[model samples]
Target: MKYIAPPRDAVDPQVFSRMPLAAWRDHAGLIEGRDWPSIEALNAHLPAAARECFVAQTRELLADGLHYERRIAERGEIATRERNWHDLFNALVWLRHPALKRALNARQAAEVARMGPKTRSRAQCALTHFDEAGVIVVASDPALIAPWDAHDWHRLFWRERTAWQDGRAQLEVFGHALLEHALTPGKLLVGKALVFHSTQAMEVVLAHAAAAIAHGELLCDPLELRPLPLSGLPGWHPHSDDEAFHRHAACYQPRRTGRSYPPAVRLGHLGRAALV
Candidate 1:
């Protein structure tokens, strides 16, 4: 099924006042209170070091043989559509996480160079998945991640629910497509998560994550990511407050046979350590 965006005028601006989007409220407010922003408006939001520009996607631009990733890496142009929720969210991501975005672009451009535009490797697939629907799951306490590795939804979401609010655990939404999907009222969003057990601040964790990506130390394979049901986080979904919701919701899938996840990235006073 094709995704049809809600009409710009018809979409309630209040829809962004929840988790994930709420985290980005400042950026969203820039475009939400007025008419859809033009490419120039989007470009103005870019940081001084952001070489990439959000250019209008046109037939003329598409006619160029360069692939999308190549266009950004080689020409520093990001093809963006006018009035597109997905593209708008992408610009917001660029504004919020420029370093991470740049790292992802660099890795993607490298992969495109290695495997031509005709084929994608496991690394490219992992990169694309994260680019579309990724989340950074940061846990101050390593113990908070055990249930997630075990796929114990009830234990993770219900028993340890307080961890989410207390800052011991956090879900930093990093994918524009995931943000676009949030436009649908009451959607149960899931994120492809890269887990980190860190004692440092989020800024530090983000830096390490970006460096790891650019250095080819992370996001090398799809299996390295964990499936995170975003709605299971308290207040993100209406049904999540009830314990039974974790047990029976369609969003809560059991762990598959032969499925195993790599250890979460570890960040401590010594800086980034090996996965544990």
Candidate 2:
């Protein structure tokens, strides 16, 4: 991959590593009991005790079932209720991490049940925010916390050119839902996006991810990399109102949350997306 800083000039370089979705979905051990025949075959997931648990919980959360493709294909909106992805390259997340997916649904369901569904309580909002978090960034050194919490986007992406190539960084963006719920949630979460990777990168690893997400979109894109609002993601106005861009981008600092972030998803455990 080539890292080019537009308008000329490079910044401080760093290195980060990543595991693509294919590495997760196609892993022999992981996929052994987790593979599904097709998107329509979600109901026929491999037989396992955990499968029953995930399916039961999934039914409760998504009354209509995880007809992810149908919903997304017909209307192009992922049902926030219960259905998630895998038919497409990015869609394979559900097929890849069933355990994590089950855990997240349980968490999301519990939060909604306790908060009465309509209440946007701080805790409820926090749960959903983390539940639907955008990125999971892991750095070699914990010291990078200070820069991350500071919302250092430009430096991370453009300046730190070698960040991901060398192994100092590894990003897991596609499995946000599973990662958020599988691990603990707390404090303000921030990431150095320059070394970031999107869920769509699974296409490169699997050689069969749908074309929808084949092209790589930079995380440090000044316009698209805005701090996500606490309420929800870009273009998702569930309750109402019109906030076009991320207007509520707040910079995280040591005073508010701890220095080291990205604790929700265990880097060591989940970073096996490497196809090599």
Candidate 3:
């Protein structure tokens, strides 16, 4: 029912990492008590000056609940509005998937309910901030997922591009922030993923991450930017291992350790590893 701006330093660096939504991290501080209302009721709650920011183009965004794909197609462009970063992001998240935000909040609230507000146990902390740190991609078939746990992101994401190209795999980034909150914790949320296939190949994720440590920037050039799909993501594969991933051959190769964190501290009933 209430949200608070976690301190910038306190904000988990790993949270929102590499994800397009990561752009919203800095704006979190601006919207204290982050309880956002439904899109149908959101505008009435905004300040008069802030209300004017929506403009004619985003009337649908402000007035109704539409999935991101539908709203973007209807608006016929990237449906973005810059209302101080927080509101813009709030609107975007709601626009993209209203269910996700609601589900994430409900799940977090349930965790708080179970663990008690003041006590952030390791599991409690992980579950509470699951949206930012945890990511999982669910595909249609078990065969399509084999490469993930085998640490074969190259095949699962890149070499296997044909799977996505043909639209056979049917990947969906789970609205688990809703799925988990509902506690139907299934096989989909079992493990972690390298990156969603739909994500753009932005070097800044690696650039920023690369800048933080020695030799990390060498992992990927800041200049090369485009959606390389699976190969574009950093740390998904052991690019540094030349026998496996040769740098001269890659269009966008990022060399980094191939290690992924679990989607949850404890998956509860969903014990299997997801993307691995």
Candidate 4:
């Protein structure tokens, strides 16, 4: 089913309390009591580190004739549509993860320059996928990735559910679209993840992911990303706690024939498989 965002006035403030939107609740809280924020208001929320690449109203960028990514790369301006949930969530992601957002913008702008704004490369597709639905999954145990790679939702999400709460595995939502989708009640959210093996703090892993992306060492191909059914994550959905849910949920997709994922990105000084 296609996701159609509700009007700003129609969105329920309670949706932000959901697990999938947990990472964004702090930013989303800013708008719960007021009308949708204007582009200028969105810019005001940007942290000092992100002040250089500020949010610009979409209309203003349309007249500039620069490609969206290129504008951010060259002029440090992110084109954002006011009152739109998608763009609003995007701005929030920018506020929370400036380095990662900047890295994605840099890579995208580089692709635009190389492939021409009229065309797109495989790398661009992967970059866009991550930007829209990406999750940074850090795992302390390499064994945890087996079920995920095999698309075994039952084993990965149910059998190993404890990993989610014990800090053995953690998911940081990077895709604004996922946050946007959570606005709909009972919507099933899935994330494209770049799993890494490490024991480093989430912030350190995120920094590594950003650096890797900016340096063109990651997201070179769409196949490199792994699918993760977000609903299966503990506390993400009401039914997920039941073993039957993992077995019968619509989101549980079987592994495709001949499909195999590449190894997780292994960071230096690893105590276990980690994330970025």
Candidate 5:
């Protein structure tokens, strides 16, 4: 998909006035995108402060501190399932494939057996245990998922790193709206490519049922990021207004001259007028 560049004056004053902490953190990628420079060009265009903010924000997002949690949940869950399947398949391959079986010794076969079934319960237990206390936990910060320990990359040597990559790609896409509308202020540029690629991930998943299922499972996992309803803000047209806005607005006042006022207001006005 073609990339859509945000306008030069992308910052909407009105939106900024209403901005919440969540919006700032959630759209940091978009802000980073606005000033992102290639590694080679990094020394020239991007300032140290901006770069610092970008790295910090991206790291925060990837670590599940930012809005990237949804992406992490969606991508992480699916990737976990896929990895489990791959592990099971590898075990089966070792056992059933003629070439693999010949290469494995009796001890190796026993070890594979110990690995056991790939059913939901076993996989869930394994993942939960590892996630809770595993030395190598996959963190979902903004657009990257690197091991907490840089020197121990070999631990995951047998694992599929592509799953995390794919998950990040998916997340970058899911956050496009936030980036476009909330992140960049004066001019948009830096992380735009990331957003574009991220969006493409979404498109690819929608086009394929298997991909959709994986993404959906990731989205539905309760332990992961939960999707929040966007109904509280203005223009959302909430489904119900049981607690009327007028009750909460400090400046709200009923018009005395109009019959449109509620019964209480009308009676109060009538009593006041009669007393005067």
Candidate 6:
């Protein structure tokens, strides 16, 4: 199939937040299980600025998912839950391309044959199951298959496309092995960390966390993470270490026996407590 380039300079951060969740989900489904147009083909269809936007967005999304997974794994309570989350996100990433989805059917046998005696016997043994069930087959429409003409599509389209590409590259570089290992029980032991402690924090925090995790650093302590509250949301406090304070506020489960519970510790407070 031919590749079409999305419009140039079409990214809008607000679109991601304001677009209806259902629309995003539907668009995701449409693109999932498809292969991306080759870089050369994309260049033909889109302007340089648009192409750059696509690349930037792709990198952002991939980095976001990777960091999120790492943080979740660090918590130590829910391996299965984390695995499921990882699987779903990974599948979503895979599904971003129709070609990849279709190719998954024959890629396994082909991969094994290509590897031959040089193949890791363990890897061959593992892929047997994925070759059978996990690869999904979905019908494709001609419009979906056509190249992106960069007409009047929404800005979010470019953003989503960029994010998907970046996420896929990350999977190829760092997460490919992780995908194989995570597929089976005991295949691997992946750690998780809770990266976002509060939704109330600035959007820049996500960018910062993504950067740190991409470079293999700890973004924050998992136990202390929480979502920052949106303005006008109940219990929103303007002057707190929002992430830490909200985490403490939300996680305040009463003890079965009534003794005074310690005050919620802010992220900044952790150092003082350590020194004490």
Best by TM-score: 1
Error of 1 at 181 (Å): 0.8
Prediction RMSDs, each to the true structure: 2.5, 16.3, 17.5, 3.0, 26.3, 21.2
Q: What would the TM-score be for candidate 2 when compared with the true structure?
A: 0.40
- Runs in model 5 with CA error above 4 Å? 1-5, 20-176, 183-227, 231-276
- The global Cα lDDT (0 to 1) of model 4 is 0.82
Candidate 6 wrong stretches, greater than 4 Å = 1-23, 26-88, 93-203, 215-221, 227-252, 255-276
Stretches > 4 Å off in candidate 3: 1-87, 126-129, 133-136, 172-276
Best candidate, lDDT = 1
Better of 1 and 5 by lDDT: 1
Candidate ranking under lDDT, highest first, comes to 1, 4, 3, 2, 6, 5
What TM-score would candidate 6 get against the native? Answer: 0.21
Residues 1-276 of candidate 2: C-alpha lDDT, one tens digit per residue: 222221111211110111222235343232223232333344344345433312222445456553432333333333332222222222344455443344334444544556654564454343334334444344554444444445453343334425544556555554343322221221123422212222334224222111111121111122222232222221112221223212233422223343333322221222323332
Clash counts for the predictions, in order: 0, 16, 5, 5, 14, 33
After superposition on all CA atoms, how large is the RMSD of candidate 3? 17.5
Per-residue CA lDDT of candidate 4, range 79-124, in tens? 7776777887888888888889888888899899999989999999
What TM-score quantifies how close candidate 5 is to the native fold?
A: 0.20
Cα-based lDDT for every prediction: 0.85, 0.33, 0.35, 0.82, 0.26, 0.27
Please say which candidate is ahead in TM-score: 2 or 3.
Answer: 2
Supply the TM-score for candidate 1: 0.93
TM-score for each prediction?
Answer: 0.93, 0.40, 0.37, 0.92, 0.20, 0.21
lDDT of 5 at 209: 19
Clashes of 2: 16
